[model samples]
Target: MSVTKKVILITGGSSGIGKAVGIYLSQKGYIVYGTTRNVANYSNFIHFPLLTLDVTKTDTIKKAVNDLIAKEGRIDVLVNNAGVGITGPVEEIPDNEICNHFETNYFGAIKVMKGVLPQMRKQKTGLIINVTSIAGYMGLPFRGVYSASKAALEVTTEAIRMEVMSFGIKVANLAPGDFATNIAGGRYHAPVIEGSDYQKNYQMSLDLMDAHVDDGGDPKEVGIIIEKIIQTPNPRIHYKVGAFMQKFSVFLKRILPDKTYEKLLLNHYKL
Candidate 1:
């Protein structure tokens, strides 16, 4: 390995968008280190080196960063791509599950960011790309918690960008609308109560969400977008990847009245 090659660390690279991005970047000549909770299970499949890391655990995150720094000397880019989805009506969703959702989707990203910042600051040049979701901009039906978690991440990314700019460390949020992945399988759903009013609607909304993901954009496209961002001299703070409507929806939400936007969302989800 060339010492001059940039070292990139991406979390949750065992599958889906993360894996695609990791493989793509590695192929582009960057030294990529993708992290997963269980390296043993995915060691054979992952193309790049896999580091054992559970972003939800601070100790594990720190250890992963240290391990990478020890071998690579410096990390040039850190992509916070590990996340989970949870679906349910707010009233019916358990508090603990919501907490877990935020722990992985929001706080876990922050923990990894913190772990990598020290090294980035020492180097005085680095990039942090957080993989959020378009749902962050507009809360989707039944997927309220997941939307909220990503929303929180988007806001945090903004603040971190301003704070780290002086250090020559750039931060950006890549809000992908929908990409075909196994995320549907890992998503947490609220249990339907026998007589709960939301039971029927909840199921409908969950199905709609799953269908969108099933017919979503390709994960390789997202990987290409990430690669472009990496190659750019200075990337924007927010990048949206998906179909035209998905990206336009964010613009529409910005200009449309509150009720009008809500109505559009309701109609789209068939709620």
Candidate 2:
């Protein structure tokens, strides 16, 4: 691969937004490297490259970085897109459940960042786009774990952006709203089953959560926005991607008082 061509490494690129972005970027002349847990059952419009990686595994991350460097000579962009959500009340969530969420969503991104930062600094030109979510901006009840993980990622992105500017390495985050993806199926299920003390409320919350997941917009829209951001000369620090929910959430938090906003959310969720 030519070093002059844009080389991008995307985690969780096997399907959904990541895969869609890979197809689009490949068509646009980027040498895209995508990572997935399952490299066997793959089908796509393009035949770029697929690397096997379980984001929680540090050795896998190191191997991917080393392999990419050896083959491409340099990486121009790294998209930290591999993440999983775990939704439940803080009280009801088990210690292991919380750790699992952090393992993939928070630390997985950090691991990839750490592995790539040295190379980016050495090259003095690179871009890191973290696939965070609108949940990063606000903490929604029952989805505390997911929101907190994304929130941490957003903060890390901001801090790194400030620190890496002199190196000409840009760090930007895409905070997408609800999108049609398998993320819900991929989310960690809290170990606390039914009939426990928190069961009634948790069950109610689960039902409400189901409603929101069903209301998701298309993942293709998010994919197109990501492509645009990548192709832009200078991307913003953070962008909210999706339909009116993106704007409405920010407005609700900024304009409405806390109690009022809570009530509105409760009414919307039918809680």
Candidate 3:
């Protein structure tokens, strides 16, 4: 292996879309470094290095960035893919739960980005891709907190893109629709909830989540699209990738009036 191949590091690469992205990028001749909390249990893949990293820890981010720099000399791309989801009414979710959600999904990405930005600035060429969600665009019932976190990520990426454009650093957002990822299965909930308060709303949220699993797109397909975006001469600010129907939803939201859009969402949720 070359001392330094087209290097890229991805967080939360243990499974689902992150794992698929690692595999696809490695197959395409890019040296891929994936970070996850568990390094012992993993599939064997050629030319892909799995590192142990806890995104919420600043120390872990610093060490991981330094290790990559020492080994590869230059980091080319950093994909902020680590995140968690919480589903419930805003009032029902404890304040601490909201903070924890942002800790992993928003601030964790910031920590990694802060550590790597200095190195990229020194080199004057790099790409930072933040994995946001379609919910970033429009809020969903029972998903207000998750949507807020992703929306924050999107806005942060836009600001970073502007600030780094002149320095040859690119920042882009990937707003994916529902996909077959562990996002639903691996979600964390507030311990405060005991299934009594807001039971009806909570039940509706659970039903919607189940429906998403049934209708989600394949992670491998989204992985392929990420590869294409990385290879493009100039990547867009945001890439919306998923089934054609999801694209149609974006179109509908754009064309429909505010009341009409609200009605559509209400109908979908049977509210």
Q: Could you say which candidate leads in lDDT?
A: 1
In angstroms, the error of model 3 at 265 is 0.5
Put down candidate 3 lDDT per residue, 135-192, tens digits, no spaces.
8888888888998999999999999999988888988999888887777778865443
Top TM-score prediction, candidate number: 1
- Candidate 1 on 144-231: residue-level lDDT in tens? 8888999999999999999999999999999998889999999887887778899888888888888989999888888888878877
- The best-first sequence of candidates by TM-score reads 1, 3, 2
User: What lDDT score is found at residue 58 in candidate 3?
Assistant: 89
Q: TM-score for all predictions?
A: 0.96, 0.90, 0.91
Task: In angstroms, give how far residue 108 of model 3 lies from its true place.
Answer: 0.9
Which 10 consecutive positions of candidate 2 have the poorest summed lDDT?
Answer: 38-47
Residue pairs with backbone overlap in model 2: none
Worst-scoring 10-residue span by lDDT in model 1: 1-10
Q: Which pairs of residues have clashing backbones in candidate 3?
A: none
Tens-digit lDDT track for model 2 on 1-271? 3432689999998877787778777777888999987687675535579987888888888888889999988888998999887877788788888988898999989998988888999999889999998878777777888999999999999998999999989889998887777777877767546577766767777776666667878777766777777777678998888769665787678888989988877776566
Residue 46 lDDT in model 3? 45
> lDDT: which is higher, 2 or 3?
3
Clashing pairs in 1: none
Which residues of candidate 2, in runs, are more than 4 Å off? 1-4, 38-47
Q: Flag regions of model 1 displaced more than 4 Å.
A: 1-4
The deviation in Å at residue 42 for candidate 3 is 4.5
